[model samples]
Target: MAILILLTTQLRAWSQGEPPYITLLQGDSIYVGNSIALQDTVFYDVLLKPTIEKTLSVYNIISLRINEFDTKVIPDSFQVHVKVRIYYADSANAQDSIDEKTLTVTYNKFSTYEGKAILRLRGAHWVQVKVLEVTADYATLSAVLPVVELENRMVINRDFYMDEEDDAITTISKDTTTLEDCQELKVYWTPSQVAEMYDLEWTFIDSSAINAGWYNTGGVKDPVKIFRNNASRVRISSDQYLIPLLYDGKGALYYRVRAVQEKENGEILYTVWSDLGDHRFTGHETNLNWQATTTFAEEGKRKSVVQYFDGSLRGRQTVTRDNTTKTTLVAETLYDKQGRPVIQVLPAPTLSQLIAYTPLFNVEDETKEYHKGVYDTLSGSSQYCSQTSVPFSPASGAANYYSASNPAAEEKEFQYIPESNGYAFVQT
Candidate 1:
């Protein structure tokens, strides 16, 4: 992709022997469907990938500025048109030649600042760039150049096994069983806890290749935006493409899905796939278990689901109450010949269940000491940002302790959960 260095570096160049001047301005979000308002305007393009495709290649964006003193027209308001020629340059060098992504930019213009995502640099040097777009906000006086190839990408695909127990009885049979209709999707990846630019891609494929296009977890449908700054709409394919998400032995990937099967005649059917009311308790109060039942309100453009710890616990209350907090967990002491606290890790919640489900743990108030052991630093490292109300420690508390649920910068309080191998918790 032909990315613009919208963020300019201080470079002095004399063109007509006058005082040298240069300015750079980057572009903002470029959305889909005919138009997505942008912070800048420039050449743009996109790569369309089919569902279930494991690998994804890049695209390009290119633009030519028209000077006012010379061309005498505002680029943003004028007839702005771009012609792109794509090429695959293995070398970051400007001298190499390669395959093309898009030969011509088709039906492109900006309604706002920057309206495009990828551009192609043709003729001189076809360099594949993966970042930063040029918008009308940029100084047209400054000369524009092709972006250089910066890095490589290993497209990681995330897969999760799901079963809708609530719909089990509605199924015709075992193989012809009914499952929760999917709505929103949450991808949780651990990027090896390293610092790297991860391009996330999200595609929910049903029986074969049909993508699940419906309301996100937050419930907003129209103007559904996918951009860099949006945590929910990760620029990459899936949120959980990193190490921990693949086969971490923890709560595997879980996507909040909502499905709506519409009839040609106009009747709307709400499948188990709907996420219109998925929520958790947000108040300070807790359920019978220490776990909070009321969840926080949806924040930002995206709503995500993360598996904080290995066990996505589910403690079914044989009873119910508004104030389930301060209740104690009852368990008969059962142990092997050796005397020890008996415990084993519980299975995680399913995608269908998690959308409307709250994590249920059996930890008593006394066992609350585990929160202290949680070490905010360690717990923060692996959280799903969009799924979590937590936040990373700007203090650089190191990896394993990153918390996406920091209350200081967030609207909700997320309980820190740490993972263990054999059991969800161990007794002293």
Candidate 2:
């Protein structure tokens, strides 16, 4: 009898060819084939036959019964049982043991179907259902919906980060990284395609001052302390950042920037930092008294001295000495508060001591020849003293010359001579 039953099952499998591919429709969702996991109680099923066109559509009314719940359609004396396996760690060995439970399903009236369908599954982790028999008046159906327990799994999401090609600022070079004067240092950057603003970070590493030739001969080093206080100043797109008044021009500065975006609901997002840029610093202070001394090699024994008072050039003196003749020419200029030269002291004249005044000349001899006096012919040591008028004031004139004998004489007052276009300085 077992041999006869195996022969009959083989013949049935051969006649059926492949398993039936059915489509279950529940509202807008469609489930296909025998691998369907039941979601709603009511759905329509369509039997798809495998032909040359694979186009045969045969509708069969399927009634599924599993998980202690059934559809609204009343089955003709139908019963269902679910095979459940609960796994637990085995105390005797390293394998897991299974506990089996056989439970019968009950019919419920919560389903409303437009057409005939079968799927009465609920509360099963891993279930596979199969239908056995069906009829008209006395329909007898047999199905197995196996429920198996599975291990829990955790999922992680991977993020896509930015690359160096999307950096916002240009590379640091000699032309862009030198800080020489008291002017504000401006750092420019390219705009990011995805960012609305940017966050800036900087640090200054104290090092030796740059040489007078504007060369950063001082060695560069890594920064030990970072200035995060400036990072809070988030800037909008394409805006140039001016370094704050925090540097004293005694060292080098390092900067790195990143992109930032803000959502409509006030959520901020940040990106990774860009490459670090190094900038060398020279003197940029303004409020202190300073002096500069320079010696020239081409001009023999030439030296220039410049003095500044309250950030303004106060005095400048150039000395040129002839080492062979033991003579020196000292020309100096003194400036007022407005940076205009107030006094210009000229070099003393080196005139010959012999004079051409003839003491024996007759008092009325018209033809007697007498050379010009040495004092009258030679230029004297004089200082050109100037008084600059105040801004928008009415007076102006030429500078006054004071001889060495009357070196203490004050500047002569002058008037503003009105011209066709503007006022001219007229010495009175």
Candidate 3:
């Protein structure tokens, strides 16, 4: 390591005595590779730790000057160099003894405005430096005496350590296992060096579309991109991530992973996406209900209906529509014991089955509510209301309202509120 001071011109060259001069702008006590840059000069300070293995040190001072003098002004080329003498001083009186007989002069020539001069001073102890002469083509200068102190300072190893960003070298792969007789997918990857955390992105496409050649590309095309941003991406510290397997139909999911390093300067650096993998998911046992349509012999006259059931084969909901009449009807059934409504917290019966395989209650003498209502075709306005528990128990002193199915009934309209718990209802 070496201490360097750089002086250069920022504008046109100055005639003889008006040339810019270099000075010590700041303190010399600086760590290795520390630098200070001013308008026209730059300084580099180097400090080495104390060790018994080495003794000699080198201090380099570089000065650069631009000689923009026209070619017609000076017929011959110009030369500029500095002469220095290195000698030890007596610590008791601090007296420097220089021998002119052993002094040497080094000439550095500048052919263009981009030339630089380097002055190397090597010593092992406190040395005194005296610029005996500075030979320039245009400037008449005096001697320059600069006393520089060179000392070996001790520093901790941590001062020399720097953090480096890590690259994601992990190979991402998928794992599948039978979960409640349904295949579940899990993504895992290998860990890399210096990885503070990881980012994961995934997207899916229907496998049927690929098989039908609907996509022009030979591989997965224009997938439904999900988790593309930092907020949505699975930012996890662990190497493995698991997401709920929602099987709408047969589909293949593609995913990638990358490592991230957060710097102390509040800047984040991320590695490139390195690992690409895919998982093919199929129909699960949870998908048990489906839809079908039927048509009549008359034109523009048809009926379509879809029926949903619970895991115990109990009817849950039925939606029916008539094309000729342009009418729709929905009916739902709920189960509870002793007039107390049963709450189905889980949306899918298979999910509820996974949590508790056995049924909790078997209602023998259960009370039910059949709500039916209708309104004019012009009355389509409705307002939202807060959700509260419906006191189905007869002891609550609430009247039990019931209505039977009327096939040819037409007068009032009904609006089903999905947010209602325990039982779905339609209000007039």
Whichever of 1 and 3 has more lDDT, that candidate is 3
TM-score of 1: 0.18
Q: What TM-score does candidate 2 reach? A: 0.26
Give the lowest summed-lDDT range of ten residues in model 2: 1-10
Residues 288-399 of candidate 2 have per-residue lDDT tens digits of: 4445343433212223333334334354443333322433334444444345664443432121111111121211123422122210123344522333222111111111
State the displacement of the C-alpha of residue 12, model 1, in Å, after optimal TM-score superposition. Answer: 39
lDDT of each: 0.24, 0.33, 0.38
Residue pairs clashing in model 2 are: none
Error of 2 at 223 (Å): 6.1
Q: Lowest summed-lDDT stretch of 10 residues in model 1? A: 168-177
> What TM-score, to 2 decimals, does candidate 3 have?
0.32
Scored against the true structure, residue 100 in model 1 reaches a CA lDDT of: 27
Off by over 4 Å in 2: 1-186, 208-224, 228-234, 242-246, 285-428
lDDT of 3 by residue, 1-428 (tens): 12222233232222211112233311122222332222111011222221112222222232323233323233233434444443432213243534421111222344334343333322212333444444444432221111111122111111111133234554788777534432235677887534556777676557876577564444544323323431125566667765334444787677778876554466676777755577777743345653434444332134555455676666655545543443444444455433332433222111121211122121111333322111112223352233333423221111111112112123344122122222223222
Poorly placed runs, candidate 1 (over 4 Å): 1-76, 79-87, 90-114, 117-428
Which 10 residues in a row give candidate 3 its minimum summed lDDT? 153-162
